[model samples]
Target: MSSNNNSRTLLVIALVAVVVAGTVPATVAGQAERTGGTVVVEEGETVDSLEAFGGTVIVEGTVTGDVSAVAGDVRIEGDVEGNLEAVGGSVTIAGTVQGDVEAAGGSVTITEDGVVGGTTSIGAGTVVVDGTLEGDAEIGAETIQLGESASIAGDLRYGGNLQGNTDAVAGDIEQDSSVGVDLAPTIQPIASWLFAAYALVLNLVLGAALLALFPRFSDGVADRVSSAPARSGLAGLGVLVGVPILLIALAITVIGIPFSIVGAFAFVLVVWIGIVYGRFAIGAWLLSLVGVGSRWLALLVGLVIGAALGLIPIVGGLLNLLVLLLGIGALAVGLYSHWRTARRREREPRRGVGPDGPTTD
Candidate 1:
């Protein structure tokens, strides 16, 4: 397979993935609609941006925004103010599309009544066009047919057998043989290393900032992790498991949805901090054994060693998990201690000698 074929295959796969993603329950923050099963926009009906994923999708009304569908069959016989994108077993257009049309399927067609104002791109097993295309047309298929009424305003580039009324095309007609999947080249290893390097840099910067801004708190967390590794690990495990459960419970309600989202982000940040702290604590402990007390040096040593171990396979992953647990647990324990102390102080009575002897505050 050639590069063009590879590109087409990727496009089709991506289209399928998009449809699958739409099935997940997620709120889009605007005037958009998403649904599964047979979807039909009845005549005289109007909708904003629409996405359908299921057996069949048909539009006979007016769409003021873009329309996208991934189904067994999709047919449009309406007015679309925005682009029309579809991937299915069959796709047909018999309406006025004010924007581009991107379609991939077993069979794709543009009926006589179809009128496109922008470029048209299609990838399918078979393609037929008998409409007005005001822009360029790039098609990849096993078979292509352009009806006598077909009118393309721009160039036509396609793959496979072309048997149609070429005279109706207003621009150049060309054949591209290489329009399928290409299986060559490997870049996963390089990409992995690059990602690791980036992560290391980010962690180093973050660690430096934490040590500088909150020296006492950072030292205390490290001390707790070093002094009570078992306790810290248990706490970390609880947090790792419990946070998700709590978030999910919150997400079950419409009112709690926003809070759940915010909590999720905050949880991620806490986990990252824990990971850094875990490494820093280990470095500090190791340095202490050698009678060293430089916090900066400890941080550098711990992070570098952690990064190196990360390159190993199973051992690296396990070690990283352990550190994350220890660090998070220590942080949690320390916070609980602070909260308790504050509460105790607030409850304690302050005495002042005055005319009423002693006054409690």
Candidate 2:
């Protein structure tokens, strides 16, 4: 079969895999899993789905289902029947996509030979389109370039410094400078307020859940933060500065790619958890000062206050960062302390009276 035919077949297989995986639980039957490596779908090859966590993902065949990559570069030179989603680094499409293309990265580029049958949405530092898009294009970037050969059958909506050839054809061109503007008056005050409210609510919910699941651990983290504020903040600052450097160093080795990916994900998870804990700590402290002691109430109050502060112009960002660092650092210290306690227990001799005599077991 030709490469195109193979690509289509692979795409179908990928879709089937997704459907099957979704309907059937993995515990029932062990499912195939791939992680932390470059994925190359060579010419005439096909895959159910292509997912890469950190390393590069190159497709030269066909993908029946979705193609997704995080903290990695994705290059498509074949065909995708389903959606293409990428985050971080860059995305280059020089093939055919039968579904929508959504990318958030440093840069996104569609070569002249590229073709998209569905909508294209890209959020990046730079976006260059020199291909054919049958559907609408929504682009948010610092810079957007449309080559002369570009042809868009649907509307083009972009926000950024846009430069394109007059010959580039599209259904309509709409430029909205507010598309990528951040922390500016691009959006209405009401919308910004609503967003802040939403974030506050979400954090409160997460904080409540964490407190319910791990009350002792949560309390311990908060206590650590209160006891050693400066130390925790310093630790957090170190992590904030050191993690990216570590990731870069790991990426230098082919064998370390998977580890780098895992570390990156772990770092993000830690930061999120730390932020939640920080808010919880703040709420608890405020409640203590007022002689009220409900964890739930504290979470609610803290989240509200934090969200409101975040709505402030410049000081809000710094305050949030400080909270994040303090939380992360406290959590780290608490873990280390726990580890030490466990080690001490393991090393200490246990005295017990046996049936015959005193013994250590």
Candidate 3:
């Protein structure tokens, strides 16, 4: 087989190794995602926040509230009145701003004309700050470069290597690992909440849509999923850790690998479906909770809740954990139920071979 064909074949075969897609869900999705698209928040664009996943986010107008994203590239050419957070390839500020800027990506740049009233925090491969910082500049990266034009009025503190083209009385500077810009940890309340919000909304919307379009199919899947959520969750989690090991094991063997490979492909397909399915399921419940009994109402409520929850703290974290557990539980239950049902069916005596004997009739 050609290399491409072999790879495609191998890819299909390898999917069987998966077990779970542990939730931290949005981040997991965005970890390898890329974003690309100009998002012009036109004048009078009254947006409370901006969120882009696995794509480019371009702000050419104004955003009045906090902007958070996990994307490919985030370019701000307008103005932000609040905080900016992202996990991306590059963050470029070429406009005016009125808040703190926090970013984790490959590189971050603030143009000479850029204006930041609050702190500028970053985690990247390289950070070139030529803007005016009214507050502190806590640059966390592999290399920090400040042009002569850059002015940071507050304390300069960072763990990464730095070369200041300008000078300041940085209150602290530490090269410790902990000081580096770090992705928010899971157990942290807000961190978990944000994650949950994303998953909940995403899953809910996806689930509702799927269910709505295919009521019977949706019901069947939901029944299965809800019935075995824990098992499914454990299975998903297991897949998270075991898939890689399984793949390695497959690679080690030759004759035993054929079917193992196909299962791997099927596994990936299942996960993608499950994620969408779970999200939609959550969306439906959210709609009902908000007193939106209409189908359309449920969708709008789900999306809105997703966005809002993403902004919340404790509740948001709970939302994430809840959806994850519930979804997994459903899947787990479905499997257990199916197994039990099958076993019961098998154990039942045949009509012709009844326990009392067919001659009784």
Candidate 4:
């Protein structure tokens, strides 16, 4: 394939990795994974296991357990006592792996210093191995190059034409016609759609619960969003930006630390509430325009519409941000109004009954 085609293929591989990685729960097997941005295992560091999602993954240390990565690129120049599984745009190994190696990328390379004690499986656009493979090797690639120093103790099964294999030592070498077919293009969209569906269901359930528990309050908030959107939005922006600053300021003092902790938790909860409320407000307005008066219907419409718009790229992100701000602001405005009403009642003078009539002082 041409270089451009290879690059496109790699991009697809990276996308597949990102989509799959995003779906993993926060914790797995007693290990918390790092998501987004670079993940690195520096030299001299030893970890039980390593699992990374998105961005680049680089390992230069010793891992007692498996090293699994779904990212843009993966480079391992250390030792893995367990298996190594990497799926990304590019994968490179220049160290010793005690267990199996399963790698899929646009470009996969195992340098001369690399050694795999277990089987090695690879799917890529271009693959080069100048290392030692103690077990069988199953590779599917557009181009495969085996260095003269490469030594495979077991059978080698490959889909593409082999180069330098004449000088490399290996067991039985067979061609597998099925290995080179690319499935990423077909699978990525399906995976993304499933993720979106999952998110929609989760949001719908949460919205339903909120509406059920606080029907009147929910309606008031929705109305606030519809009637005073500009005010609500401004409030939301202030809360979003101001809350953190307040929290930090509180945390700076010894006595205010406890309050800060409580506030932090409350802030997270309020943000979630705002997101839901914002969507509900839009839905309620839309329903009003059509002369409908059903809270459930409004929530459904708003959430569905929000999810649909989220599918768009930049526009979707911008809209979601606006929705969040509006929802948060509306909540702030409502609370402030309640506080002011209470204060006003406290300040009002009481009326006393006189012989002739009632009198206020």
Q: Taking the candidates one at a time, how many backbone clashes does each contain?
A: 5, 2, 45, 1
Clash list (residue pairs), candidate 1: 5-179, 5-180, 5-181, 6-180, 6-181
TM-scores of all candidate predictions against the true structure: 0.49, 0.53, 0.41, 0.54
What residue pairs are clashing in model 4?
A: 236-329
Answer with 2 or 3, whichever has the higher TM-score.
Answer: 2
TM-score of 2: 0.53
lDDT by residue (tens digit), candidate 1, 215-285? 88899999999999999999999999999999999999999999999899779778977988899999999
Q: Provide the RMSD of all predictions against the true structure, rounded to 1 decimal.
A: 16.2, 12.4, 13.5, 14.0
* Residues 1-361, model 4: lDDT tens digits: 5986776566556544543443332322234366644667778877789877655777787888998887667888999899998877789999999999988778899999999999998888889999999999888888899988788889988888788864465588889867645533333344345435655665676677677666887898999998888989999999999999999999999999999998997797688778878998899999999899999999989888878777777999899899999888988887788899999999999999999899998
* Tens digits of per-residue lDDT for model 2, 89-182: 6789999999998777778899999999999888778899999999988888888898988888898888888888635755788887665444
| Sliding window of 10 residues with minimal summed lDDT for model 1 | 180-189
Per TM-score, the best of the predicted structures is 4
lDDT scores of the candidates, listed in order: 0.80, 0.75, 0.60, 0.80
For residues 1-361, what per-residue lDDT tens digits would candidate 3 score against the true structure? 5976776555434332222222212221211232222334554444656765534566666777777766457777878788887666678888867888777777889889888888777767888888787887676677888887887777777767788774643345445554444642321334334445645544454454444445555555444544555655676566556765787688678875875677676665455555454544565555556665454454455445555655666897567545544554454455566799999988887656577767322
Query: Model 3 off-target regions past 4 Å?
Result: 1-38, 43-46, 168-177, 184-361
